[model samples]
Target: MGQQAMDTFRSCIPLFQALSDTARQDIILLLAEHDRLTVNEITEFATLSRPAISHHLKILLENRLVEVEQKGLQRYYSLSLDPAVAQLKALIHTVETTCCKESF
Candidate 1:
């Protein structure tokens, strides 16, 4: 890859850069409850304003951390099943498993 493309790819680390801890935890929790959610549902569930949810969704979407689907007039968001998202989850799993080994 070209330097610019490499830089852009590195800049888009959804597992790290796309969200703060609070927002990331919130998104994870919401996904656990429902496989998919509309922006309005997220806003209501998170107790965040609509605009705030929109902004977070934009970042998550750009990073491929979330996927979107259209349902008539509504748009729903869900965890992406793409490679990057999978890798991110795998990384987290590795860390958790390592920690468990150390504790036991």
Candidate 2:
């Protein structure tokens, strides 16, 4: 692989890792549906404890997959259609078109 492709693959690792957990996926789906929600609001639909929810949120926050809104004493989190998702799709395309192309 060229340096550029390798770099893209390397960067995609963290984004994929962040999304690999079921809890995080659930949180993302919930955020997608609601647009924005507080931690308590997210926890209400979750089977995990508040701390676990916070932990999942932290991972999502670090990945830049979710945005935060602070209102008075509350913090609201919302899903972001991030650049990372586009980058990931591009990387997948690069692989499919090159390494795994259909035989002709």
Candidate 3:
């Protein structure tokens, strides 16, 4: 692979790794059902500590899987579909396009 392709693949690694964690996965599922939520609201559904929830949110934020909307003192977390989907689509497109073009 070229430098650009390698760079894109490297960038996507964290996203996949982030989803591999059960705690992070649960947070994503929770966000999917609701429009948005704050840490306090999320804590109501989870057994994790406030700091643990915050930590998972931080990873999800870093992976571009979720976004936060701050309203005054509250920060609402929501799933960010386009970015994660785009990255996945890019990876799929690369494999389908490049791999299929090759001869067996």
Candidate 4:
């Protein structure tokens, strides 16, 4: 792998870590279905506690998997997956082009 591909793969580490948890996956699905939701709203549909939801949200936010919108006193979280998806696609392309080439 070239340096650029290696760097792209490294940059995706946090995104992978954030998505490895079932709690976080549930939150992502909820947001996808609802468009946006507050921590309390997410906790209502999930078995996790409010603090646990917040903790997962923090990780998601840090990884850019989700975005937060401030409305009045309420904060609504929603999916923000374009950038992460692009990075993953790039990594896949790099691997396909560099490592999957067939010899004649």
Candidate 5:
């Protein structure tokens, strides 16, 4: 792979790690369905405890997969997938243009 491809993949590692967990995936889907939700609200639909949900939310937030909004004392979480999706798409394009070309 070229340096650009490698760098793109490296940058995406956190996103991949954030998405590797089933709990995080569930949380993402929940947010997608509901548009936005609080930790306690998400906890109601999930089998995990509030703290556990918050932990996953933290990871998701760190990776930029989700965004948070403050409403008084409550915080609402929602998907902020555009940046991550654009990165993944760039990775795909890099692989197609570089790796696949080299293979052929």
Candidate 6:
């Protein structure tokens, strides 16, 4: 990959940096299983303190990795199928296909 493409991919991974491993895993699992979540819900499910969840959410939001919607008094968060995710998936596909032609 070119430097710019690689840089973008590297930067995207840092959205999970503020999270503990378990917290990061929980977020991924939640996104896979649910359509959306509130901050309180994520904090409870992830077993992180509310402030920690909020910190991680900030990174996710700033990077456009997650979308936020305000409904009345609550803010809901959901995974965003943005260009970064698409590009990362495409890159993974290329690597897997080229490196493991028979299996992947």
Best by TM-score: 5
Task: Give per-residue CA lDDT, model 2, range 1-104, as digits (tens).
Answer: 67767787888888899899999999999998997999999999999999999999998998889988899999999998667689788898767766675853
Each prediction's whole-model lDDT (CA): 0.71, 0.88, 0.90, 0.91, 0.93, 0.71
Candidate 6 residue 71 C-alpha distance from true site, Å: 0.5
For residue 45, model 4's alpha carbon misses the true position, in angstroms, by 0.5
- For candidate 3, lDDT tens digit of each residue in 1-104? 65666667787899889989999999999999999999999999999999999999999998889999999999999999789899988977766656566743
TM-score of each: 0.64, 0.88, 0.88, 0.93, 0.94, 0.65
Q: By lDDT, who's the top model here?
A: 5
Question: What lDDT, from 0 to 1, does candidate 3 have?
Answer: 0.90
State the displacement of the C-alpha of residue 15, model 3, in Å, after optimal TM-score superposition: 0.6
Better of 3 and 4 by TM-score: 4
Candidate 6: C-alpha lDDT: 0.71
TM-score-better candidate, 3 vs 6: 3
lDDT of 1 by residue, 1-104 (tens): 34544444454465476656677558757866798999888888887789888888887787777788999999999987475656665555555554345642
lDDT of 4: 0.91
Per-residue lDDT of model 5, residues 1-104, tens digit only = 77888998899899999999999999999999998999999999999999999999999999899999999999999999998999899988888888784653
- Model 6 regions lying over 4 Å from their true place: 1-22, 89-104
Lowest lDDT sum, 10 consecutive residues, model 2, at 95-104
Instruction: Order candidates by TM-score, high to low.
Output: 5, 4, 3, 2, 6, 1
RMSD of each: 6.9, 2.0, 2.2, 1.9, 1.8, 4.0
Q: For residues 17-98, could you state the per-residue lDDT of candidate 6 as single tens digits?
A: 5333566557757976889999998877876788988877786676666788999999999987575467567667655655
Which candidate model has the greater TM-score, 5 or 6?
5
How far in Å is the alpha carbon of 82 misplaced in model 6?
2.7
